[model samples]
Target: MAEEFRLRSVAAVAYGPATLFGLAEGAILPVIALSAIDRGATTAIAALVGALIGIGSLVTNIPAGVLATRVGERRSMLLAAAVTVAGLVICLVQAGSGPWALVLYGAGVLLIGMASSVYSLARQTYLTEMVPPHMRARALSTLGGTMRVGLFAGPFAGAGAMHLWGLPGAYCVGLVAIAAAAVLVYRAPELELTAEHRAAAASITTRDMIKRRWRTYVTLGSGVLLLSAIRQARQTVIPLWAAHLGLSPTTSSIIYGVAGAIDALTFYPAGKVMDRYGRRWVAVPSTIVLGASFVLMPLTGGAVSLALAGMVMGFGNGIGSGIVMTLGADVSPAIGRPTHIGIWNELADIGTGIGPVILSAVTALAGLGPGIIVSGVVGFGAAATLWTYIPRSGALRQARAECHD
Candidate 1:
């Protein structure tokens, strides 16, 4: 009745800045490293820059979410945009190497993660607030699909911007995107708090909030951490190794793009599966398949093998990405959906952001093959954990089917 689908799209647009932050990182990380090298920064310094961002994200993401809940999702969105813009301005104006660049870029990247988390948490909570329970899975799936498309497109766009206009130009583009997101958010409607929501908000304390959703939080956090580790290992290390093996940057980018596209295309079907079967049923097998794909990654050479690996990984991720978020929404404490989603999202970011750094360190210590192989093993191990503890959604699906029949 409220044009639920259109509003969700608008909410997603409100999240465009966060999406841009993600793309900016993916697109600009390689370029940034190259720029560092060009500036005569040591490999250690380059690695440090990456680590700073992760550390900052791990620290600020939870607080950002908490703040979002206190202020309202719309306010949080605007706050995130303002923070991101300020961060960009810092990076744009900063000069010198050593402490100065490190401080500025480190702070910039931290705000990137914080602001991005705010936008993301707000988007998910706002969308869930708008959609009916029956339509939630499908709606989330569509959002996830759009997210995948944005993520996939962002890096390439960043790369193109970098190619044509250099670092400064790319930063300018990111800034423009953030500004556009802020404008969209300003135009989007505020979430109407139902009586239940208002009551929940009034009654739930911070401690009580965590106690209420502990199982849901722990499960989602663990699952996303494992998922992020598996995915980031490839996203970060494999391409570098591929480059060392004489593959061109453009070729590597193409492979990554293809994988992401495959994931985006399959998201809706995966959501349908979750809606029909259950979240757990879709997640468990897909998680395993994703791990297996990572395990298979190091077993081949050149673009063909990498492409195959990407396809496998994409298929696995596509099956459950949206459903997972919907599951988070389902289990979240009604009063603090934004805060709960943010905490889990932070865990996700921790896993994702720290993943590349950890994998890279492993590769540096023991070479790429062993590092990648271990990543696969760890992912599989995580999958086994999910299988053992998480409940299946099949019963819910069956009940609905019976009703329909």
Candidate 2:
């Protein structure tokens, strides 16, 4: 079963589109706030703009999943890419148009966020339905790794574009990348659902499905939410901390890029460990390490030390690649996979959206160091929750046992 589910041509086709989408997303993410800043928004407002992506994702998550079920994964992805392109065009047209530019750019970012939610849901549903259970972790982990590779490469690409054509040019790169992804997805082989799978999916309403799985979704899903919050906080806090430390933008970018490289390198091994050992093996350590990195951030007095902390955090993040997705897949009912994933991702996006807001508010009330320390505490709390709840084996075992009974 594992051999049959390995990275075959079909998987590669899905991955190709994902890779391009990731690259596009990665190129824009690190710079959205900076772009807003350049357009004359205050730091707080700029951060809000960055957070809008998550907000948009939150709003669209369930709808995106429903759309995927109705239209099929391929068509949903294509529609998402098209919407993303429209957003990019708006950003490009309004570049450097002063305050109005901020509004337009924010709108563009929101649209892209909507598109991303759809794209991600489509791909995740595809993998969950197509890949066998035994190989699911590795396949999803590889998907995570591919996205990291794009993210690792994106900042550098944005930097170049910024140097040459300023911030809006980075959006141009994203536009082009997503366009290519759409083309690839269009050309990929169609995913056909088995008759039984279709019947199962058709029998359940999204609301009914959520009601049935509320226990696992709320209990285990809370852990996923906190983990996502910590991850978002890391992304938010790092650059702000670097600025506080008086590091050059160039230096900060390099440090983040290096950390991303470490993250990308570890995805496959982490997947292997999850598949061979258990999800807990990777989950516990990753959460703890990430928390430790946040706790240690204030201790770093210089760029070198900060980089080290980033590297440690990145390593932690790397080891848990696709973990949230894997767990969602594990517990999701086959009949309502898309709807379950939608709810799972919505909870996670809420965390992502709120993390930066919390950081910003905390930093304003106390200080940057203290704000980050608070985030660290949250991470520790999440780790504790996972340790208590995430099963020794994958959640699939429990899910299967319940189905059998």
Candidate 3:
């Protein structure tokens, strides 16, 4: 039965698209704030532009999940890729121009965010259905790792593109990668739902599912929100830190790219540990590591120190590749799973959106160092919450209750 699952086929067909899409996103994401800054946006405004991606995701998540359920994952992905291409085109066209250039670029980013939410929902839902429970973490972690591979490669690629054609050229790289992903999805083999899935789909509306599962959603979702916030804060803070330290654009990208590579290394091990020991094994350490990195970032005096801090944070992040997605999948009901996942994603996106704004505001008010320290404090708080609330197992939960008694 395990052999029949053919994980390889799924990886080849489904995750292939993810690899390309990740590469595209990775190429552009590191540059979004930089591009906005080049166009005369203040640090706060540029961070806001970067946050638009998360804002877009927050808005479209539920809709994207519903769309995936109605149209199927492959079709949804194809549609998302098309929209992403269009967004890229708009950004490219509006690059470095009139007074409205930043506005137009932000609009384009918003569109891309919408497209990404759809694509991510489709992929997550499809993988949940395809892989068996015992190996689910590993499968999803590999999926996350594959994307990281693209992310690891992308900055170097973006650097090359930036050198050859400048900022607009980075968008072009994403456009091409997403276009290729679309083509790959079109050619990939089909994934058919079982009778069980179809029946579950018919019985519950997305809204109904959420209403029934609100408690679980809120509990787990809070953790997800914090996890995502710290992750996004890392992304936003690192670049801003480099800029604050007066690092060159090329040097900043290299630091981020190298950090991504570090992040890519631990996905498989994280999965293994989670499967064998439980979620806390990976979750606690990841959060703590990230928190430590953020707290220590401001103390660093040079680019090398900053790079080391970034890599330490990357290591934490790498081990948590598919953790939020994995936890969401573990808790979601079979009925209306996509909708639940969408809601889960929405909470995460909210954190992603809020992180940058918080960092920016704090940076403006206090200092960049203080802003990062706040993120670190939040990370430690998240870790404590996860440790307290997330059960090790049914038996463990019982044991804890007995201990309290």
Report clashes for each candidate as comma-separated counts.
0, 0, 0
- TM-scores for the candidates: 0.84, 0.90, 0.87
TM-score of 1: 0.84
Indicate whether candidate 1 or candidate 3 has the larger TM-score. Answer: 3
The parts of candidate 3 lying over 4 Å away from their true place are 1-5, 30-48, 94-96, 99-105, 194-196, 199-203, 242-252, 391-405
Which is better, 2 or 3, measured by TM-score?
Answer: 2
Worst window of 10 by summed lDDT in candidate 3: 394-403
Tens-place lDDT per residue, model 1, 1-405, is 454555346555434544554555555445555545444468887666556556666777667667766677788778888988887776665476666666666677667766666666777777777665555666677777766666676666776787787776666766777787788787777777666655556455556667876776676568767767776665665576567568898898788778878887887767666666666677777778877887787776878988888788888877766755676766565556666776777667767876676676778899887777777776786677667655565335433543463
Please list the C-alpha lDDT of all candidates, in the order they appear: 0.68, 0.82, 0.82
Flag regions of model 1 displaced more than 4 Å: 1-27, 34-40, 194-205, 240-246, 353-367, 394-405
